[model samples]
Target: MRAITLSEYGGPDDLEPAEFPEPKVAPGEVLVRVRAAGVNPVDWKIAEGLLDALLEVRFPLVPGWDVAGVVEQVGLDVEEFSVGDEVMGYIRKDTVQLGAYAERVAASVRLLARRPAALSWEQAAGLPLAGLTAYQSLERVGVAAGETVLVHAAAGGVGSLGVQLAVARGARVIGTASERNHGFLRELGAEPVAYGDGLAERVRELAPEGVDAALDFVGGGVVDLSQELLRRRDRVASIADPEAVAKGGHYVWVRPDSVDLTVLADLADAGRLDVPVDRVLPLADAAEAWRYSRTGRARGKVVLTVD
Candidate 1:
């Protein structure tokens, strides 16, 4: 199998393409022929070795967690799928050995879900990590119908999904984005407010009732900004800053949540979930995609396509 290997952590130059032995599937896992893989911030952060203290890495590791592909083989106890099922998943991120950057990935059956029939492999690949995170944060804040939820970075991967999910849940959403993306956010059923100086005032003008729940995908003092506008402290959450989240009342980290992923798949299958895949590159160009994502300028998801 061809995989992206990062022996050490640094810039885009750290990632290199190489050939590796095909991974073996365990009793409760499935072998997936990688069709497309989602590139995320965590991929690059791990490349820079930020999680080195809490997590151990296998040297010469593959570095991707999300995959959308066809199941080539199923393990002995995998009852829910067979040899030819279309599946998608965000595999465990702790271990560096098994990941979606390879031509094939061995994913645990529990992490796998039916790929939304309406979504292409590239679009499906973008959902597991970003989609589940948005779902979990909203659920944690108890966002309900008619409540005004403020979504920071509404044009971003997770924030875009959060805006849509909040609307689907019947929340009146006030989203913060750049002037260019206001129309896009409005189409997602959010009242778009420009993100910059006086963001709170803009949101207040849009929803004077104040924000009931706030989800921040961009963490540079966003929680504090939300706190200034939101009447209640516990309804605010952030995926970007754990330090701020710890001090910022109600918050949730996007972990490996298979249950949430299942719901997200149903939403995508129902046309409730939409992914704007900005670009696709080969596995060999994984570094370029990582660089693009690091810049925080992507219109949507960047995917790595594999045969």
Candidate 2:
């Protein structure tokens, strides 16, 4: 198997393409032939040792979690899928190594879901992590129909999906982004608001009474801002800010769940959700993808296609 390996904790420059051993298929797992891998900020963050204290990472790490691929072999006791099944998953294991950046990976049945026919391999690869994050955050906040929900960074990968998911739930969505992406947010069914400098006022302008719930995808002081506009202070969730819990709001760390991933797939199949891909690079150019992700300019997801 060919994979992008990191010899040590470093940035994009540290990533190298090399021939690696095939991943082992443990019981309750399946070997997937990788078709596409989603490039996320967490991949580069892990590469830079940002998650050192939290995760157990090994050397020669393959850094990717989001995958859209075909099942090549099934391990013992696996009955959910078989060979030739098309699947997409957020395949984060307890230990971080041998990930979706490779030509193949072993993912647990708990993480796998049938890919939505509406999405391309790149879009499917992009959906798992970001979509799950947005979905789980909305779930945590208990967003409901007819409610007004505010989503921060609404044009970025997770935020774009967040806007669509919230809208699909029948909520009126207010999303924060730059002026350039306001139109994009509108297309996702969100009332676009420019971030920074009286952002709260802008949201208030849309909902004079205040919002019912808020999701902070690009954390900072947005949790506090969300509280100011939220009818209930606790009706906010933050993925980027850990202090959300201290502030009486929810801080969500996305988890891999087959059920949740399936819900997203259903939405995609129903034509209610779309994974906007910003760029698609070859697997060997994983380093370049990381650099592009770090730029913070992508309108949606970035993906790496395997040959």
lDDT of 2 by residue, 1-307 (tens): 8999998999999899999999999999999999999999999999998999999999889999999999999999999999999999999999998899999999999999999999999999999999999999999989999999999999999999999999999999999999999899989899999999999888889999999999998977999989999899999999999999999999999999999999999999999999999999999999899999999999999999998
User: For residues 161-206, what per-residue lDDT tens digits would candidate 1 score against the true structure?
Assistant: 9998998888999888889988888888888888889888888888
Q: After superposing candidate 2, which stretches have Cα over 4 Å from the reference?
A: none
Query: Could you say which candidate leads in TM-score?
Result: 2
| Lowest-sum lDDT 10-residue window in model 1 | 244-253
* RMSD of candidate 2 to true structure, Å: 0.6
Residue 222, candidate 2: alpha-carbon lDDT: 92
lDDT of each: 0.86, 0.96
TM-score of each: 0.97, 0.99
lDDT of 1 at 196: 87
